[model samples]
Target: MNHFPPLRLLVTFEALSRHGSMRDAAARLNVTQPAVSQAIKALEDYIGVRLIDRSVRPSRMTEEGELLARAVREGLGRISATLEDIRAMQTDADRQITVACTLGVATYWLMPRLSGFYDRHPEITVNVQAPASDLPVLSPGVDIALRYGTGGWREGINGKLFDEIVCPVGSPDLVARLMEDGVDLDTAPLIHVRNPHNQHWAGWEDYLAVKGITRPRSSGQSFNNYVQAMQAVIDGRGLMLGWRSITERAVLEGTLTEWPNGTHDLGTAYYVSTGVDPSKDALLFTQWLREEAT
Candidate 1:
């Protein structure tokens, strides 16, 4: 029998190491802070080494901890991939494909035009998984992913979709209300997108600074996902930093309007990568997506 700690304990420790905070790790694992601590202690007892250095303010992993953490990440990743391969064998061939992307892209962008693909090929079922991060790992079951970056993901075959452009956008009513009320744009209530991987998505600070408009970072609602933030904007709650890939359709449809400031051409672009061996349906969907972008 394997004498290592329980898999759950190792999983919890991995989360804690990844987040660098017990509370944040617990949040990711859906457990309490004390539970995280207990799990770490249990793992330490099993491994006979202190995984965490409690002396640090943010509680970092010790050298021994780093070694174990690396091993766990790699081991779990391999195990997960093997399980996915087994599941795929049980599943019907070429009937199902999964696409992974951020919630905003899935909601405002891809979901709007998904029916077109289905109309052409009704046999394939596209499973869209919109996780919190724009750059999520393309695990076993996921056939493809749409990520925003400089196109160097070795996980699969990747290609650039298009260069990204971002700007301030809001509902027509909200802009009109702010104008009528003579509210200062800088101090006005605005939407903010907060994420652990903040670099992937541009925020108000980057937008305002590029436009030479100084503004306070603290304003209106802050949502962890753009789906909620954009919804808040549609409800006229506040204006949000918007990107072409996610907000262009909404603006063109008159559901949203761009503010006076010009757009920012983020040198980086969005990219799409596919699994090692994608199904014919997956390839068709990818080709359709590429043609649509042009």
Candidate 2:
């Protein structure tokens, strides 16, 4: 390996790039502004390139400086992430299972039913993670994942949770008004959920096409996630495609009303998948999930 700048100097430079001002970086690192400037100078001397362009009022990064800053930022980020993962793996090994699922499933389906699991196995803890992608996969540090689709996943041991039944649902008032007006699916204000990661799920176009109905040029409001769309539906904004696992409880509780004639089987189902080397605790929780789904 070649000679490199000190870790402290690189850290200071990284802070300077992030905060965009020596004073701010100094305050963040709990040091004087002159100390921040000195660290940047030391880093530049070691790298043999002008990192900060002090010619400007606020002190901007040169082209090389920008490139170095990006590298440092990514490098430090990865290091921090890896360290956290390592610590989690060490501490979370005993009696803990990390389950990843979509936000909709986590919020509406899994969370409402977790009390039973805890009741049965008080010694074990289940950690639920809802990734921003809205799609859950068996990833590192994640013991199990609840995935929704027609089962073709080749990653780990897969178990069927339940077959997905997607139906259009709306508030009770909206459903009553629409029914009274004799408004069918074609003319009703339909809330749509669309996101890049939601490809596994059905959208308005798919649902309409399946029912042989054509949506008009003007459509309803669009949201990126199910939570927001469901909120709109609850508020009587429009109808939304509701999955059986997510909306069944709400429907039963009268929070939302489903159109009996609008139900469709999209041939998709939810599956619980475990990592290649799943922990015993993960298997235990997976069994509970199967029992609940059944």
Candidate 3:
């Protein structure tokens, strides 16, 4: 519907105009002088304009060529500017990130502290995903993963967020009742978290084994994830192994109570993982996370 010279012809003409010589334009465009001359000839034929004054010694642009050069320079400059604006918009879109973590960690730890991140970086939006498998993986579309482990993940750039401290926790009322009844820590009804995808998680058996106490498997009830287990513990159903990072707020708020002398260092910590070529927004978020953990 519209008639226009080939973009290559226009580009060659522009280069020739800017450099004032076909040889210089060829060097700038990495083309032979003949190719540059041919492109200009093609453009001239297409536009029916004598753009170059061959009568000059070094070959100069004619009056009409000077006008076309101005239009071409302005058009190309605007195109470059619009391209940069599109790139900026793409960078802004990248500010929205997806973080993977356990349900309990998302519910208790990350969600509560996210307000601080939003306050610091209003432009960044964090989308938290709790994997069905308690372990978080840096899968495709996942920007960052808040993983709990001893920190040897082969996935991405891994950094320990903070040390993990485990302890027995129950509802305040249940804890009070158990203490009043003089129930031993090991003998308390334990709430267990178990799943096929669960790796590196300390269960009731592992915790009891660490304390040199053995209990029957029937001594506790099991849940697929920490969220359900924590709710049951809060409802005074039983005591669950609580990670300090996840349950510290609940204990502080008096919704949950920790047993005295129950804390243990399991030699594990929460780590943040991001792809090697992380986006600027992802780097900002990880930095914020490290600051928060500190």
Kindly list the per-residue Cα lDDT of model 2 for residues 152-213, writing each as its tens digit.
Answer: 89999897889999889999999999999999999999888888877767788888898999
The number of clashing residue pairs in model 1 is 0
Q: What does the lDDT come to for candidate 3?
A: 0.90
Tens-place lDDT digits, model 1, residues 181-288: 887557778889898866656688877777677866776689888888889999998888888988999899999988765577878887888987777888998998
Error of 2 at 63 (Å): 44
Worst 10 residues of 2 by lDDT: 193-202
RMSD values for the candidates in order, in angstroms, are: 16.8, 9.4, 13.2
**Which has the greatest TM-score?**
2
Scored by CA lDDT, what does every candidate get?
Answer: 0.84, 0.90, 0.90
Worst 10 residues of 3 by lDDT: 199-208
Model 3 regions more than 4 Å off: 1-92
TM-score of every candidate relative to the true structure: 0.65, 0.69, 0.67
User: How does residue 207 of candidate 2 score in lDDT?
Assistant: 86
